[model samples]
Target: MNRALPWIIALLISLTANGVMTGIVLHRVAGSPHVSDVVRHEHRHPPRDPSDAARTGGFNVRAFLRSLPEEQQQIARQRFASERVGFRELMLAAQNAQQDAEAALRADPYDPQAAAEALGELRARRFEIEAAMEAIVLELVADLPPEERMNALAAGRRRPGGFGRRGDRRPSPRDRF
Candidate 1:
């Protein structure tokens, strides 16, 4: 019993030591600036580009709303949630309209009337969707203070930089100004 007890005690001590060492290493790593930067980059939300919004099927107005006060943000979020249903329907209808228009244009012998009708349908769908989007945007910012609306607008207008991250944007020394 005595022999086994000493071994058990040693085992417990070793396990505790191992855990403490692991925690210390992790804490050091977590606190390190380079490590933190990598971690931050991993977790940070990328800024939204309005052009990408079309591909995403919805604009990220939610991200822009973060600049608003808490109460206003909540109101905006709720409005977005409600409008999403209508937005989804509009998207589907527009997609179908576009497909129909393309199919008409591709038809043999080129039925001008059919192509014109499809074009009208497609344009109507596009205008309706655009108008709906504009209405939603107007409603969203209508209650917002001008400053916040500006902030939201500015945030969305950020286009991706033309150069790659490491690519130098500055002109060469010999280049004319």
Candidate 2:
């Protein structure tokens, strides 16, 4: 019983430590300002310029291209054309990996090993695609005039998918004002 007694005491100590940490985290979370309060605070002080949204986060290449003047657009298009084929190929591979992962997960025998391998491949493919996308965005941003770069990057702050709030087209900076 001596050996078991030491183990039981260790378990009790671990549990107590975990409980204290959890309570501390919960208390901090409860004391934090609510999301609505933060939103209200922000709304009280609007951006000086609507284009400020682009400087903050999210990058939609299509929207960025459309915002450029015709001459700049032509330059950007030439740069993008060379990369688009590889980007599309990467995207297709990622999609196929996703399908394979899904199929592995749904297999009749339910092989955990196979599912894990498929998921790993899907993750790697996704990482490749994301890297390719970041490369394209960075190159484009570098090529853009300083004044327009932020707007290009900030295209998707309020929503996901980078296109817009509802997966539709994103409104240009002009459309906001």
Best-fitting candidate, measured by TM-score?
2
Candidate 1 lDDT tens digits, 7-77: 99999999999999998899888885555455555566554455775544444443455556677766766
Q: Stretches of candidate 1 above 4 Å error? A: 1-63, 160-177
Model 2 poorest 10 in a row by lDDT: 155-164
Error of 2 at 3 (Å): 89
**Residue-wise C-alpha lDDT for candidate 2, range 39-101, written one tens digit per residue:** 755545543454454553344555566666676667667766777789799899999999999
C-alpha RMSD values across all candidates: 17.0, 16.0
Candidate 2: stretches off by over 4 Å: 1-58, 156-177
Clashes of 1: 0
Could you estimate the TM-score for every candidate? 0.50, 0.51
Q: What TM-score would you give candidate 1 relative to the actual structure?
A: 0.50
